[model samples]
Target: MTEPGDPRFGATHRRFVIPTVISRATIGGSTCQIVVGVLSSGSATQRSQRGELRAELLRIALRGQGLADPCTVGVEHDANGAPALSSPHIGSVSFSYDGIWAVVAISPSEGRIGVDIQMPRRVSPTVLRRFAPDLATRADDKSTYSEFARRWAAREAASKAAGTGLRGELLRTVLPVARAGRDFGATYTVLDGWTFPALSLAHKD
Candidate 1:
């Protein structure tokens, strides 16, 4: 709903929904915020065109923060592979793009942030068992898919924010359900009341 950018995703006349959220804070007299943008792909064609959508969203987000020449801002990776902004002011950036959708999170101050977005889809029981056997042991119901997706998203987003990627125990870790309050700036939203799979944004000091 926020003005990130718009590109029609093909889906038999159906409109793909893109939602953006900005969370703000202040650190050492500098304003800090994380902008999260999600793009829903309705068809294969639109999914393939996500690259442009991502870049445009990034540009818009930067410009909205009064950054100059956002389109030309360079993005680099640290030794741990977390993304960093080459320009000053903006601190760190992280994004994740599933085949069907994507989410980008940008931080405007000092700290690391990560984001992950996913469109709801069926998950094979076998696959779920491998990554999260604890979830597999639970009963099957309508909430099963949503819970699974959120747990996955939370784990991945946290991993990325930690700049550790998915290594060691994190690779197969299961995260707790998102709660209203948490430390380390951990927050997540499942848009449309779980109509969409999941969107998670977190930061590490």
Candidate 2:
């Protein structure tokens, strides 16, 4: 397995592809970059089509991992509005999307895996204040958006790796990651009998 700081996942696999409206897409190595996309239908922002796309994407991604046959992936909503996979066969996976950029991951019994990706968005003082309230104060910095996207992806990836959504399951759980760097995980919120590895996924395309 590649170490967290391994140069492979960062400097290579600069670009990737995802099916039209897939649950997510991940294409990056240990030292490369990852790309993700979501498929949706209807006028709703979080279209249900994304759920379908995510499932298919999951199967495709896990095909070589030995857990693709009985593949059964679907979107499930938790109390905190966090999305999770509904499959007993899936040990762990990550899901993230930023309109044009989306990504997800499937974990194997003997390897580290997690991914996240987001697209760039228009920023303004008032809009950023409400839309991305978390980073409103840091809008002046050019890397603020990237930082927000990375942190969001990191938290979601870490949570997915832990198999728990926001709803207090990730309560008191905080992920440490670079606002604009690769290999975001070195440690995670360790639980009683669960410990998560530091997985990384970032993109710009």
Candidate 3:
């Protein structure tokens, strides 16, 4: 039987995998590429398997950018557990996964970029108030869950790009607006039926 890391046991062996270029958008001076795929189920060690899947996708993303040896690229995480390329800096990357879907965002420039995927779900008023008061104020009984998902994704992406990871007052302060200078800015788009909020931090001289 094939082990976990074997190419035959994971996404590499899947025939219906999505392409590396799901969508591309220009943020500031950086062009961010979004890559997405669906995860296979039935793994006894789901967490480790998912991590390996994500790493494989990152390698594919790096390879698309013309990296000489994508397999040698290493992913390092900050204190907040936000991932970055270890050395020979090709670009900045951020990713998120929900259910069976996973997505990766790559910025082929000095600017940092983040991406998040959120699925629509029931959110209570109190939970909304605590997490996203600005959105709560406009919330009504008829509110669509997709709106909340998008808002959550936007904030999460902003925090990831800022290297803060939703800590402290980040969720409240990081709005979907572009700040004056050297701040994280976010934009929302739908790729492969997933709503993603892509973030980019302007490079400071």
For model 1, the superposed segments whose C-alpha errors exceed 4 Å read 1-48, 126-134, 137-139, 180-195
For candidate 3, the lDDT comes to 0.59
lDDT of 2 by residue, 9-112 (tens): 22112233333221222323322222233333331254555555455455555543455464555656667554445763444445665554445555432223
Candidate 3 positional error at 70, Å: 1.0
All candidates: TM-score: 0.69, 0.47, 0.72
Task: Give per-residue CA lDDT, model 3, range 36-100, as digits (tens).
Answer: 66666554248777777688788766765778688888888877787788863688888888776
RMSD of 2: 10.4
**Pairs that collide, model 1:** none
Q: Give lDDT: candidate 1, residue 23.
A: 45
Stretches of candidate 2 above 4 Å error? Answer: 1-35, 38-46, 67-90, 110-115, 122-138, 167-205
RMSD for all candidates, in order, please. Answer: 5.8, 10.4, 7.4
Judged by TM-score relative to the true structure, which candidate is superior, 1 or 2? 1
lDDT of 1 by residue, 4-109 (tens): 2333233112233365544443322334333444545554357445656656556656765777788678777778776778875666777787665655556665
Sequence-dependent TM-score of model 3: 0.72
Q: Which candidate has the highest TM-score of all?
A: 3
* Residue 41 accuracy (lDDT) in model 3: 54
